[model samples]
Target chain A: MPSRAIQENFRFLVLEVTKQIESTVQVVTTGDEALIDSVYLKDDYIDNLRGFIDAKCLTVIRDADEGDERTVELARAVDIVTNNLERMADFAVNILRQYKYVKDHAILRGYGLEPLFAEVLGALGKVSEAIFKADVNEALEICRSEFNLDEMYAERFHRVMSELRAGGEQVEDLVTTLFIVRYLERMGDSLLNIGEAIISLALHERLKIHQYWALEETLDVGRGEAKGLSLESIFETRSGCRIGRVRDHREGAEGNLVLFKEGQRDKLLEERAGILFWQERFPDLVPKILSWHEGEHHASLLLEYLSGQTFQQILLEGTSDELRAALQALGTTLRAIWEATRVDEPVQPGFLGQIAKRLRDVKKVHPGFGDDDQTIGALRVPAFADLLRRAEAIEAELPAPFSTFIHGDFNVDNIIFDPAQDRLHFIDLHRSRRFDYVQDVSVFMVSNFRLPVLETTIRRRLSAVILAVYRFVQTFAQEAGDTTFEARLTLGMVRSFTTSTRFVLDPSFARAMYLRARYLLERLLAHEGGDWSTFSMPTNVLRY
Target chain B: MASDNHEFRHESLEDRTSIAKYLNALSEAFANGNLTFGHNGHAIELEPRGLLKFDVKATRKRGAVKVSIRLNWQEDEEDRDPSVGSLVISTSGEGK
Candidate 1:
């Protein structure tokens, strides 16, 4: 039997899970809308109870006398079991929410989930008993019962998909049912994790849970002829891409290979194509694509790893002289790329169209965005709709500029600079295309200023680099006479700052960027009745 | 009686001119130490007292922005309440 503290918390957790499961069953069986609120409320209570049990278990383990290893193991098992129980409760809530999507569908009312629900409840009860009593045999039985739940989920999933594919009018209903069954399967998986934790406690052996199975699969080096390979995750993005370093066992072949995995296949293919294009044309500046694997469910690419710190790291750690050198190199590299890809024919500028579309997107996400006083502090900034109107008017009066193959996402973090080799390498070329050079320039400058740090010294250093790059680009293009430079740059800044809100999650960061975008819009409106050519860039552009 | 204790009343005014007028009225009431606001059949009355606590907060998230100003005061009692601590004010940059 477990200790008093473990047994007490386990009893509370079991009670909470039982309540959650009952509410979920009520929602599915009775279609009682009021019970849905109870389900969510109970889920919240279960979450709090889980936190309390977790703290109590930690206290038990910490306050245990020396040489009390058995108590520590029991406490750890209780912690793991309670956590899984909480997750199971969450999945129950998810099932209820998904059920709402199909509740009104006529086809779903006759479909029965009673047997599967009964089996899941039985398994949950057995697991709870196993945890509270430290019954290894019962926990093992729960593990065996998971296979049945998986089979039921698969059978139901296939039936739902077949119905969906048959092109019935209730396709939405079928899809929601599919998700509901999937959540039930995931709940079974959570129970299996709890079962494994119990077995580990009884046997006094550490066992790896299923969630770490993917890492274990990746570490399995038996598939290839390459020997002694090590994998380390280096970066992850919101798009679910995981980039890792693959080092070889051989002395010379190590640290030269990078692996990109776990993102959309088409995006990975596009990145591979982009890298190949640049590798062929600008051999010194792009990593060479080694090999690619496009499997049924997973896609990945292997590329040569470039050695150096990113431009962001350089800016943060390098000396002023080093920063200036890096900026000059960046300018020179951009000039080369532009010169090579510049098209003689001028295309109608798409600046206004892009800005208009982004404004609509932001407004769609937040209907009452610009009406709040906190948006621009004390300033009376125009609404996004008004800004779009002014931008349209301004675009009509401006001449079309030349188009070049510009890096669509030319942020500092995407560029790597090897000071030893005096070469710059580019990554994340997914957005590369032919566009206005000012877009790249604006993104680079704004990205630098958007660093979280706001020290005056760092700001001055960054401002110097931005001004130097601006001067270099202007002189290179001989665009001093070009009337559209300042106006286009301002519009680019507006686009950059506004669209950045989609990526930033922190409230203050989002507000600051929104205010900056509004500030640019205010500047643009100030020149509404004046000459567009004579409008100068703001001196405070890079100061922030 | 429990339902009545839990009753809530809310009114929203969006027009700038009308909101300004309402604000002026509220300002006058604060100066007079009593305020009563009502719309349609629902209304609330508040009496101002010594030592009002004021809070101003601004928040932006997921493309939406909000600024809230709240004032609160406690009714005087003969026995001191331990739960009521010293009033504290903290401020940060509007956009930081």
Candidate 2:
């Protein structure tokens, strides 16, 4: 039923969305204000195109002959594709708008988003090719390549979340980064839909691309068994994986099974291998890997569903006693993990490298902060760049301590605590490795303190927990005679305070954090003979 | 979108003195009820007789500040004195 004009318009819409994607990629990678502004300008044009397509599609559908199923179906497909392309363009505009915030803040350089833009642009390019050529093979490639985007999204999302949990400053920028990646992932999803629609038109058969892929994975269970297995959609990961709980009604599986489809055999196998490794070492800590399937086109892992509340949930609703208990248990678990993973060899602490990177990010976001007389809140802070340079020089004189195994992402949210069984479980352990134990300790302390609640009671309780953990860690460091403990902790605090800038949008909270970091840097500079142990942490550092 | 009856002119001035000179020339034309200007052999003339509308605006963004002044008036109508609104100016210690 669609006319030639409508078809041409739809093609043009696809091309325009692709162009928008290209421009967004450029803006994100290069931080070009002109490109960002141009994207904003194109928004009106994209909206107008969407309106024109909708009108044309409606006219075609109304004018179609009675009982003309093919024409009607074709018109519907065009309408769906047009709607998706328009949404994709809207997301492109959203990315640019967020980029303005990034530019204003100047946290551009170390986000590692350029590679993601490249991947998304590449995926979008293939989608455009598939749509233009009406090539089924190209369309299939787009569908298959979605897993790559999902993988990248998951990696970036988890990393940012970890940094946030660890008190990485630039919270605003990191959160924006998360949204931008999410938009890119959604754009990829729409592109996949467009690719599927093209394939459907070319083959003259309706195909739901995602559903087809899901069915393909489910059918591997055997056709007869697949029919009885019902999948309820849970949520999609940022990395584009379709995750759901599958249950066999006929067999009455004891627990709901989690389904993970990466659409690639090797990647899924790698994940399965990692899960198995954790299951072997920490049997009670991770979910059980029940079964896995690897097909020619896709791979999936079925994991046992662990029933309990995540630590994030408990933190919100749990009483002070419950929180204290959780923190105590958390400290014990961390000690166990550290004991299991600590190495005899001492390596240089990456304080200078880490602080230098964050300082650069801060400079990027608040270039004016480099001025010595810049006032943050009621406090006059020295040039941030100069302070960082001083901190680097001070760090050069300190000793590097032994490394320990740590949950690289020690955010409470990733932890699951079963009070009834008195057990602690961990998820999203992809970043687990041998690193500074302070990484976990600092993240735990900050995560507790960073909860959105502002009530005096809640703040006091959270502060108490932070103090308890700090004292516990300090005791351990003293018992072990780790003289560099204070310096390492100071560095961790610096990372936390500066990175808090990204997360806390409130001007007062941000200024408090900036002033806190400035105070610590001043102390580090004033301390003679590099004796970090004598450097006292201000009691009011966490006041805000 | 081309019009034969419409004429437009543009010029950039180096400083306030040059801007004042241009404003003086335009003010004299308005006072005489006849406006004329020539540049690069292109010239225009008009007889103005109407109440004029004046606008003033100031804006600051992204480190740049701009203040714009504009005047618009109709042609071939009886002249009338421009109406003035109540004006109250206050200065703060903070410099603009």
Best by lDDT: 1
Top candidate (TM-score) = 1
Tens-place lDDT per residue, model 2, A264-305, is 566566556656656766788787776666677676666766
| Residue A79 local lDDT, model 2 | 76
Model 2 misplaced stretches (Cα beyond 4 Å)? A1-233, A236-252, A257-279, A290-302, A358-381, B1-96
Give interface RMSD (Å), model 2: 30.3
Give the per-residue lDDT of model 1 (tens digit) for A1-544.
3457567767877877977887787778777778888788787788888998898888988888898888888889888888988998999999888887783545655456766677778888787668656665677667755777898888888888787788957888888877877877887888788888886675455533331223223444332223344454445765666666666565556545555344567777777777766766688887776667665555666677888888988878887656655665676687778778777655555565776667666655544545543344575646765766667777666643677776677888999988777677898877776767888888887787677766756665665666666666666555425557787787777777777666565666666677667777777877887887678767454444
Query: Model 1 over residues B1-96: C-alpha lDDT tens digits?
Result: 011232345578567676787678878999998777666776566667644555578899997977787886544321233332221111111111
* Stretches of candidate 1 exceeding 4 Å from the true structure: A1-227, A250-257, A360-382, A397-400, A479-483, A502-512, A525-533, B1-96
lDDT of 2 by residue, B46-80 (tens): 66643344556779999898888787654421122
How far does residue B51 in candidate 1 sit from its true spot (Å)? Answer: 39
Candidate 1 DockQ category?
A: incorrect
